[model samples]
Target: MLQSLTGVEKHNIEKKQAKALFESTLWSDAQTIGVTISRGFEWDTKHIIESGWEQGKQMVVPKCNPEEKSMQFYRLNDFQQLETVYFGLQEPKPSATEAVSPDQIDLLLVPGLLFNTNGYRLGFGGGYYDRFLANFKGNTIMVASQQQKCESIPVEAFDRPVQYVLTEEGMKQSK
Candidate 1:
């Protein structure tokens, strides 16, 4: 019973933590770093979009070929250019154009239902970002509410770990 109550308390704490971190550091830091959109994460990309534009940092979103199970990224010059798609998450349309390579990104903002301090994450399990992240060497961060924290997450060989966990409260180091 005590454990159950503690879990509930932790859940609430994480939610507030996620919000506070954005208001404090992550948003401002994006001015210089490029962030990759994770379609349907719990974050309000509208703020991220506006902040990215205001800061003049290139904002990129993931584009995946479902059957291919692989992912690539594209830069959106403005938030107005983004539109709602398959998952109800806003994304920039590929207009007969290409995007910058993985190595070019300064940071990656990932979405997940759960994340651990160990850098483990459980995404939609599509393996899109998981596969792409394997080749990425830049700042990889996950923005999850506190409730999403787990003691440990199950990881497979192909699943990669993030470098940072930015919750609403503050920044938690992963690596």
Candidate 2:
């Protein structure tokens, strides 16, 4: 549904959601933020990136290591430094900067196709975020549309739940 969004729909929804995120206490208090590069029909993260830059907050973007099936985050200085990687998703270039340990992140914005009330998400099947969140101690959140929130979803034991889910309407704390 996200990929099929019209220009107006994308603009209006993302604007509202990003505004809520930027105004949230989590976003304000966080010094180092971990987020993904928006690809295809995913939620537009440009607003968040630009806002972070203006706030002088450190923004980190993930670089997936397909061989190890893991992800590492590096500081994002400019969008021009990103290169398309696996699955046509943009990732931080290897020479961007040194990796920031997961524990150093203040807040993490996870990406997903859908997020349930329980905080379980249907991701792109890469398990990158799931693996990273396993040992991450920072606050985790996902920005989703109302239609993406379901009553329940199939979750495995290894699946990790985020602390919050922000939508166009408002934020929902995980149960």
Candidate 3:
């Protein structure tokens, strides 16, 4: 079903999703936000980052630390600084060395291929976000389509649940 949203349909849904996220108090109140660079059919977060920049919010993106089996958030001043890495995904350069502490981030925009209404998500099987969120103390929000919210998905002990989810339909609290 994920393949069904194409061309104009995908663009329109992404726009609506971005708009809904923009209108949320979560986005408005955040000073520093942790978000990922979307690839493929993932919700395009470029819109959110651009909007956040316009709003004067500090934008941060993750750089995977494979050795540690974790990810770290780095403050991104410009999208031009990101380079495609880690299995063809755009990430902040290692030279952009300023690390943003987890406590310093007011909101974290988590990404997932599939999510359950219960808040569990099926990631790229890296467990990077899971490790990061293990100690992160902030609001966790995911932008996804209603279709991605499934009835159930396999979960592990280390899996973490997001506090909220922002879909094209609207934002919903996830337990």
Candidate 4:
């Protein structure tokens, strides 16, 4: 359903969602943020990254190690610090960006295809975020559209729920 959205509609929804996130206390209080460089079909995150920079917040992005199925976040100062990797996913260049420890992040923007009221998400199969979330103690949130909301989704023992969900309408604390 996300992929079928018209370009204009998608842009509008993304803008509204981003604005809501920007107004959030979580965003305001956070000094360091962790986010992914969004893909074509995903909700645009470029604006959020730029907004973080404009606010003088430290923005970090993940670089996945496919072999270990793990990810490490790196501080991103410029778009030039990213390089395309498998499946055209943009990842931080370790050589150009400094690694940031998980505990150092003040907020983490979790990504998913669908989310339930409980905050559990149906993430991409890799389980990279799942592993990362296992030990992460900071605030975690996901930006999603109403269309991506579901009544329920299958949950596994290892799944970690986000604390909040931000949509075009506003932010909601997950059950």
lDDT per residue, candidate 1, 27-109, as tens digits? 55553344545332245455665656676777777777778987667887766666676667556678833476887777788
Q: Which 10-residue window in model 2 sums to the lowest lDDT? A: 94-103
lDDT of each: 0.68, 0.89, 0.87, 0.94
TM-score of each: 0.76, 0.96, 0.95, 0.98
* Segments of candidate 3 deviating more than 4 angstroms: none
> Mind giving the per-residue lDDT tens digits that candidate 4 earns over 101-163?
999999999999999999999998899999999999999999899889997689999999999
Q: Which ten residues in a row have the lowest lDDT in candidate 1?
A: 32-41
Candidate 4 Cα lDDT to native:
0.94
The residue-level lDDT of candidate 1 at 171 comes to 78
Worst 10 residues of 3 by lDDT: 1-10
Q: How far is candidate 3 from the true structure (C-alpha RMSD, Å)?
A: 1.2
Scored by TM-score, the top model is 4
Model 2 CA RMSD to the hidden true structure, in angstroms: 1.0
TM-score of 2: 0.96
Whose lDDT is greatest here? 4
Angstrom error of the Cα, residue 128, model 2: value is 0.8
Error of 2 at 130 (Å): 0.6
Question: Which pairs clash in the backbone of model 3?
Answer: none
Which scores better on lDDT, 3 or 4?
4
List the candidate 1 regions with Cα displacement exceeding 4 Å: 1-41, 96-98
